[model samples]
Target: MPESVGMILTLIMNIALFSTANYLAVKLSTRNVKRRIIAGVVFLLFTPVIFFSTLYLGFTWDDTGWGAGIMTVIYTGLYLLNGLILLLSAIHIYFKK
Candidate 1:
């Protein structure tokens, strides 16, 4: 398989795994702690996706290097979304409010 194809496959798999994991975490979280679980999962997923987005897409923001040269925006966005979900979960868990 081509390198690009492999990268795509890897990205798909990452999405699948993260989604499944998040679902499980949310399902397992206590009723009162559901939000925390979600936030945690989103945060967990976000870290890798954000990191890879920077690497694979090679984003750059002028001199700051924020966003640029992104090769896979769709997949990267999915990752970012996953991260957001995890963040919400974490917030719920930590604050417990």
Candidate 2:
């Protein structure tokens, strides 16, 4: 397999893994239809945001990629989203009982 192909595969895998995890976690954590929709929508929106904004290093092709941190904010955004979902889940559990 070509290095570029491998790199692309890895990138897609990253997006899929994170999005899928978040989708399931938030979807099952709450019964509210609105919250479920929001969780799905956020994953959809986040996919593109992380995809376009992150720089693909040459490591994709076994070469050195530009060590740019331009898309670092996406990481922060993901962390924030994660915390938001966890908090929302806790709130849902609290009010449900």
Candidate 3:
């Protein structure tokens, strides 16, 4: 299998893990606002990481410079989104709580 395929498989696995974890966490929680917010944060954090990592793997394996450049742009956007989610989650968990 190609690097892109492997990365996609990893991404799919992450999605499955995250979904199951989130479902169980929510089921176990007391349904408070804080718990909901934290769950949202976890979802947000995992999504962008999978996206950026997949793009990186694809970019690294691709032979065409243009494909690599496009993937680079996508990866950068995903990275920034992940950072933003982290910052927002920190603020929400600290100041908002």
Error of 3 at 78 (Å): 13
1-97: candidate 2 lDDT, tens digit per residue: 8766765665566568676777686657566655555654565556555554454542444454542232334543674577565656666665776
lDDT, model 1, position 89:
54
Clashes of 3: 0
Question: Model 2: runs farther than 4 Å from truth?
Answer: 31-62, 67-80, 88-97
Residue 80, candidate 1: how far off, in angstroms?
5.5
Regions more than 4 Å wrong, model 3: 2-8, 60-97
Clash counts per candidate, in order, are 22, 1, 0
Query: Which has the greatest lDDT?
Result: 2
TM-score of each: 0.45, 0.44, 0.41
Model 3 whole-model lDDT (C-alpha atoms): 0.55
Residue range 1-97, candidate 3, lDDT tens digits: 7857755664565456545764664564433555655655665666666566655655566656455456546554544464455445555556654
Of 1 and 3, the candidate ranking higher by TM-score: 1
Ranking by lDDT: 2, 3, 1
Scored by CA lDDT, what does every candidate get?
Answer: 0.55, 0.57, 0.55
